[model samples]
Target: MNKTNRKKFYDSQTWKSCRKLVLKRDNYLCQLSIKQNKLTPADIVHHIEHFEDNPSRALDMDNLLSVCSSCHNKEHPEKGRKKDKRRMKSRRMMI
Candidate 1:
């Protein structure tokens, strides 16, 4: 999708509700590192999976995460596999 459309999609009401649920579920803490870092309310809601795969999932609290921008950036690796893979790897390591 084009940048404009992508921006619109990201800024839609669905995203807004999804983000709100994530923030509420996590109590506004960054779930990635579980850090209570200060951040704008807008910066808290992050997608656990790509929006393309399941945009509807964004609305599901189970599929959302509260994260600061820094950790979110690290979670979303631009050069390698996407954030979801990294999260799975981390989960496997934990187990």
Candidate 2:
């Protein structure tokens, strides 16, 4: 889907309801935090399998994860990783 359509889907009532359900199911706690022996409130309901890659499972509860912004970033690092690579290249060129 295009960016516009993807944004619309996220803004839709269905997505909203699903997000709420995931949060409730996870008890509003960041799932990653539990592994580290910490409790953190989740601010996002992230797709375990990225929505773009597997749109069919977009609404699957088992495919959703309640996560904080930090954990979400770690899970989906493509964008950040690219930026980091660019910065590293620039630093190397300067050295």
Candidate 3:
């Protein structure tokens, strides 16, 4: 899907619901971080297969994983987006 369509899909209620379900399934913990034995909270529902490359599986539970933003960045460094220092802290973050 194109960037516009991808954004629209991500912004949809369906995606939001799916994301919540995945996070719940993963216990809101970062699945990637768990691989490293860390205990970070996940705030994103990431596609195991790139959503753009596998749009057909975008909403498939088996295709999703709960991930922290840092892990998500490592998974897709090609995006090259910088972390915004001014972003609000998550309530779930222990600090």
Q: Largest lDDT belongs to which candidate? A: 2
Per-candidate Cα RMSD to the true structure, in Å, reads 9.0, 2.3, 7.6
User: What ordering of candidates by lDDT runs from best to worst?
Assistant: 2, 3, 1
Report the C-alpha lDDT of model 2 over 30-57, residue by residue, as the tens digit. 9998899999999999999999999889
Top-TM-score structure, candidate number: 2
Q: Write the per-residue lDDT of candidate 3 for residues 1-95, one digit (tens) a residue.
A: 88899999989999999999999999999999999999999988899999989899999999999999999988887764444332334433646
Q: Candidate 2, which ten residues in sequence have the lowest lDDT sum? A: 76-85
Candidate 2 TM-score, true structure as reference: 0.85
Instruction: Provide the overall lDDT of each model, using Cα atoms, as 2-decimal numbers.
Output: 0.70, 0.94, 0.90
RMSD of 2: 2.3
Assess every candidate by TM-score.
Answer: 0.61, 0.85, 0.81
Candidate that beats the other on lDDT, 2 or 3, i.e. the better one: 2
Instruction: Please give the lDDT score for candidate 3.
Output: 0.90
Rank candidates by TM-score, best first: 2, 3, 1
Among all windows of ten consecutive residues in candidate 1, which has the lowest summed lDDT?
34-43
